[model samples]
Target chain A: MTATKPYHHGELRPALVAAANAIIRESGIEKLSMRRLADQVGVSRTAPYHHFKDKNALLCAIAEMGFEEQNQMTREILDDPEDNNNEAVFARWVRAYIRFAHENPETYDLMFGREIWKGGTPTPSLQAISKTSFRLWVDLVAKMQQRGVLPGSHSALRTAQASWAALHGMARLLIDGIYVQREDLEEIAETVVDLLTRTTPDSH
Target chain B: MTATKPYHHGELRPALVAAANAIIRESGIEKLSMRRLADQVGVSRTAPYHHFKDKNALLCAIAEMGFEEQNQMTREILDDPEDNNNEAVFARWVRAYIRFAHENPETYDLMFGREIWKGGTPTPSLQAISKTSFRLWVDLVAKMQQRGVLPGSHSALRTAQASWAALHGMARLLIDGIYVQREDLEEIAETVVDLLTRTTPDSH
Candidate 1:
């Protein structure tokens, strides 16, 4: 994009990100580096430096890409006309989140676990997309409650917040190998959706 | 001990582990290097090699310590005298688990979120502790069903898993900055406990 561009390295930024992800997969986020990534992507060191001022910039970009993917996943589930009920809709969203975490553990980790926003702000672009994903949940839960799918007196707002955690914990742990058995995930995921939606006496 | 002891560091092994954990805390585990860790700890380069075969070994030991700390948290919570009752006991465990996640994000991540049982056999040394935690909820639900407080059907098991997920999810997100207000956490924690336990639909 500038005078720093190499003759053969036109899309060096994307290439670096892809290479970093590959290295994360083989080893983990710990081993990824600008020089190493540049070498693997066959780009000059200065190419990555131009796109990402530092490694955090690269990580932030990866996180933004991940958020886009997450938004797509959420949209796919939430916008699906075939999800005839609240339970079905929520279940689909949870599945999408779990799949996203499983496939893109590094990106997911960067987004969720890191204090990348430590200076009182995360990368604005990524944060906005992440908020969109969360809003999808908040809105969905509210709709479910309005339909009387979620109990009313119990504070649906709290339920929505807790609901995010439940799915996040399950997916994070599952992907991290803390809970390796694919055997029980479906049952657990379905139970989560139902538990969030089911009516209880306190609501009445 | 006999062969590898540097004159300066008689216990280079434990010192290296401590240094590695410090590195993990200050920087993400991805940036850690044996040489860098040694430099930080004021040890010779070869000193780390004698203690840690590699960084992975050091990481696993740190993770193992986390697992052990997790045990202490759960055990203390469960053993609280006021937590003898089913409702109180489960709530205590939830609070402790959440606190552990909040107080030690990196440790919790390493213990539970890092690679899924490194080396593929799923050694899962931590499984017993987690299952014990799981059984605490399962048993409480079983007791509720026995007391006619909830359904006696297989739904109880699903409900238990869901309940665990909900509590776990709340804590995970709270630590991850998904829940910004810390004061809201105590109130929400109590709300989740009361709603799930006290408002059994079966009681109707």
Candidate 2:
């Protein structure tokens, strides 16, 4: 109580974005509301309105953050120099991607689920960021192919789409609580890596 | 309306199931309700109660029907004698699978989504049927491996899990209106076949 600072309007945007993520992660996405977020952030109801046009805008902001986080993770994997074996690095990346999805299931859903892309309109900036993130993955797939980490028989786009779909599928299955269990992730991930890299571990 | 026959109480269960499917197809899963279904079928609201204990039970029934339909499709693909080239048959199966998801997006979602399996408890019968359906797919994968349709190096379960996850991921990406487009399914499917079969078409 000694130093409670008043919220400046400039800080309002980030504060609102952070608070909105908290609300979504705590409860389901359906439970989030602009008014509730504003209230939680210790701001007037209209304050959030000044920053976000509607609840959709707030959601897009959250999805945007998700893309940024995912893109950063991709970059970090690409930049990692500890492993000269591209196969091992690719496997590590697969585990890391699935781990990210498991740790942040709600945000991962918001990023890839129908909530923003289908049920609601994504902000232009959100679309741009999402596409950029995809491009990064595709480029990584091309680099992997060049390094023989993935087969070069197919175009990078097709390979990326197909393999990424596998990863997305595994992540979704885990997130949706389908046949997959969290404990089986390591084995499943290794198998996926084997399938994508076209490695014959059994033969060796 | 002139030749409308009154539904006998004996036929209420199947009638309710049929009406539920129509409702879900016409609108969406959320629009379906026990009372609504009864009214649509010209029965008392309580009549649906006898057939389905609650909405979850009705939903499980719908999901159960989906599994049966999916199983039948898988069987037909497996039994198809028209194509002896296992690779061609596998590609055809992949294309057919994506088309099924595209055509029955809502049902597919219900069958696989968090709606029945995660958000609600699946009926015992639903669980059994779903597992059987998965077993059919796994068996097919093992057969393909034995025939050199897919790589034989991995276990059937792992190969099936990895490749099926790729298919499920692609179907879901399309279903959820993500980056994948319906028009590109054929090309993408061929690429998937090559990846899973480890066939380098570019080599020749």
Candidate 3:
């Protein structure tokens, strides 16, 4: 039960995940391997294998953490009773979403990048959390639509997908060093909010 | 000038670019190299170096091709006076944009992915053409707004950035093996068209 136990039986999993994150942050994800991670965590080489079968599993765990953080962030926005204004909450969510992606570029990349979704297998737990994160987003979209924060012209699923794609696009552009610049993040997020919230000219 | 000559005097450059594309398409971008490209094009290993300083140069060439093709497609769509309607042309552009990404996933990834834009130095030609491609897109967006195809509320640059981000996001989610499914491309594209074109509910 000592707080300083680096390789305690129950503490090893989180310690490994934390260390893996540090290693990835210091270097890139490519630099974080199970063998190196075990050494960094001050554990036996096989100790990490007990937790993560391989690098992919460890990546999935990190990605799962990202989804949980995303889900928690979304939940806070949706559940905040103090801010009943859908428009304000939606704006907050938009900024927060892009901010998370910008701040956690590596984790965001793993959460949505080809490494897990295409190049490697995502653990069932990772998939489950990822799906839940999306479901929460869709639910939030539906709520926004009902309150006229978003257009009701499309279904919740479609709107969520489209809007999420917009956010994801902005995030990826910033993260991947594409067209968007980090300084432009706030502008892009605001524009996205306005774009999604504004009624179509045809509807008017 | 003989087309049959695989390594004709001045044809080596185009030959190398073509062979590089084939190698990347068959194996993956990671499998491509200037030396291998020269071998594949039936030229001396040093031949590719004469044209492309390194693999990055070759990749820039391929990405340059993608931007050229994109610009050409946009030009064709915008110049088609036979279909003067903005809505129809805008929809076509969206479909074509996603189609280009889907059909040329490798090139699209290289063009927009971290490999060129982040990890590798983009040649001046690549930067120029990429900027041109985006400028063309922004110009098209402005035209759509003028014709009421897009919302007139946001300036062309903002609207262009936002809409392009949406389209890019959709392409990436699909390409990166994220939540999007290839089968759902049409549905998502249509929904995006709807999302962007429909007047914001508040406007009413």
Query: Any idea what lDDT model 1 has?
Result: 0.67
**Candidate order by decreasing TM-score:** 3, 2, 1
Steric clash pairs (candidate 1): A30-B30, A165-B169, A166-B169, A177-B116
Candidate 1 Cα misplacement greater than 4 A, ranges: A1-9, A14-32, A76-87, A115-121, A154-156, A202-204, B1-42, B79-84, B115-161
Docking class of 1: acceptable
| Per-candidate iRMSD | 3.4, 3.3, 2.1
Candidate 3 versus the native: TM-score?
A: 0.87
Note the chain A TM-score of all models in turn. Answer: 0.82, 0.89, 0.90
Distance from true location, Cα of A156 in model 3, Å: 1.2
Of the two candidates 2 and 3, the one with more favorable DockQ, higher being better, is 3
**DockQ, model 1, C-alpha based:** 0.40
Per-residue CA lDDT of candidate 1, range B48-145, in tens? 87775655556667777777776666556645666446555566666777787777766665665544353322234445655565566576666665
Q: Where is model 2 more than 4 Å wrong at Cα?
A: A2-16, A30-51, A81-83, A199-204, B1-16, B30-50, B81-83, B199-204
Best by DockQ: 3
Cα lDDT, model 1, residue B60: 64
By lDDT, is 1 or 3 better? 3
The DockQ score of candidate 2 comes to 0.45
Cα lDDT of model 2 overall?
0.81
The deviation in Å at residue B64 for candidate 1 is 2.5
